[model samples]
Target: MSTKIAACAGAATLAAALAAPAFAGPAYTNDTGGSFRWYGQFNPSFQSFDDGQEDFNRLTDNAASNSRIGFWLEQAYGENTLRFNFETAFGFRSSDGVNQLSTGDNVSWDRTNIRHVDFQFDTARYGRFSAGQGSMATDGITGADFSGTGLGASNAVADSAGGYAFRTSAGALSGVDIGDAFSDLDGGRLGRVRYDTPELAGFTLSTSYGTDVLKDANDRESYDIAVRWANEDAAGFALDSGIGASWTEETGKADQRDISGSFAVLHKATGLSLNLAAGERDIAGTYAYAKLGYKADLIAAGSTAFSVDYYDGSDMVTAGDSAESWGVAAVQKIDALNVETYLAYRDYSYADTSAATYQDANVILAGARWKF
Candidate 1:
């Protein structure tokens, strides 16, 4: 098996092997044991655009939120429990019908990945703490709002001139997904510890602290902190929001700060949901995305959903310039097949470069996926 598949499978086996015995001490009691879960997805999309080549395919085991797939291990030991996850996957693109894999596939181990060898421990009075490679915990919103369209990796805040072209995919590792989501901040893997308070009635609170997993020569640490609240879903509607920041001090870089916040309210009744998010990066500038969508009862003998998204990131600071972009898509589910089509456009400009000042780009996507 390939390294990717092997790692993914090994992680899964470990999670299974950790299961408690059918009958045992306090740790294996019926009240102290929970089950394990495996989740996955495959999203392969095609495209046609105005800038880059048209007609391409991209697949990720985890889509919907960011095309992520992994197994979650949750065990109960009285009032406290523990959880862990692991996943192995890569980013792929296609043109015509050819699968064009990138060379970075060798190490995308950290790109668009959901499981980063992480673990969470919980105790009734002590709250919960999680550590390992993980996302900075805060308002739970950053970059393109998890559009699952790869908004920040290959595609970030597009300038007003070029626009943050939706034609470019951002996935999790935006740069490499575009230029290279594998290096530096492509889902920059670091150390994170999170503490979650016990839920009271219908509300709970959480806080986290994190550090850069990969440090520069100077050995400075990137600090992350934030808090969030959540309530049990009510009448098919749920809400999530939070705020936090990232700061680092080192030799080659000035200690910079990033303050980000976002809120989302979801309703499942009547097949509809709206997502709105906006955030600012001290170094990335600023980026925000909004989406409104609905699942139709039926269309052409199949179930379907339509949605539109708008993005703005001209405020992002770059050595070159900035960009802007937009995207729209419709997904249809037929029998066991799910198909989706999308179109995107971007406009970009240069602030310092003397060469071509701008580029107008566009892309169209089509994809059909099935699962076991």
Candidate 2:
């Protein structure tokens, strides 16, 4: 364990020394106020997991923010604007895909990897409307954080080593994996039509109806509604919050419903922040998450951020089940190089009404993200 830590530290130091600066050029604009641009980022990491009975290590793409590329086009007409967006992942081996039996599986390019292929129209007074494959109304309602450490830490606990299963006290593999017990209950993208009301006093309302269009699975109807707010006070304090509800139903299946929300506040002067989130599923589960964070200009390169978070969940996988997790992370920004390097550690524990006792699992991740 000591040797692995030392090797990771050495590799991080070498990466920092060899990092090069990269930047994106200005967008191309026409005489009629139309513009086009391309963007992307790469996030890769070295991860280690200890599942009580065994240890595992691998180099994989960060599931929090994987490598991706995108393009955007926009045109303006008076107070209204029309835009199009297209984004997709690079299909690399992911951190969450590795496990005790396999190192990892490199995903191939497919329609499911396409994040956004949508068109939107926005007006100053009437609000906005969107169509095609894109985020639903409640997409980010459960992930409000201002700590600048989201690349390494967030409300989602399963993104680190979710595939690894817990071992029983008798050194046998437990059927449950990390992902099965822990979830943020966040909304996702789909082939949908959405509408957002214009901001009024820092608050906006949104709604959407969609389905799974990228996959060939059983089709289910999904609907979502959400409200969001953001504001800054005279004392240099910033606040962001959002709440949302979603429902899904399919033939011959039980209807699934969930409500989730999150709030975050930051004091610019001190660079201290707090974030909280909670959610409940109609079927039979609840989860709450919290994080305390601090950031400072301690380095000439850019800002440095640190955070610690905890998660408590009940009845997520089955009745009488309890899941708990905690993690700490640090991120350093290199503004000149358009890069951010991070290190994070997390521990997960699970319990249930069963007679068998399950052991804990822990993971360590270190990596860098380069944006351009």
Estimated TM-score per prediction? 0.63, 0.96
Residue 162 lDDT in candidate 2? 87
- Highest-scoring model, TM-score: 2
Alpha-carbon deviation at 128 in model 2, angstroms: 1.0
Off by over 4 Å in 2: 13-26
List the global CA lDDT of all models.
0.44, 0.90
For model 2 the local lDDT of residue 180 reads: 88
RMSD for each model, in Å, please? 10.3, 1.6
Q: Scored by Cα lDDT, where does model 1 land?
A: 0.44
Residue pairs in clash, model 2: none
lDDT of 1 by residue, 1-372 (tens): 143234433432332233212331122223448766655444443332233333222322222223345666788877888888775444432222122233123123434344467888888887778888665455243432223333211223221112122233322111212221101121234567766777666445555566655443436566666555444376677666555666656678766666665555556566665656555556656556566666665767465666666655533444434444555555545442332322222222223232333333443434444332
Collision count for each candidate, in order: 45, 0
lDDT of 2 by residue, 318-349 (tens): 89999999999999999988888888889999
Q: What value does the lDDT take at residue 352 in candidate 2? A: 93
Which 10-residue span in candidate 2 carries the lowest summed lDDT?
Answer: 12-21
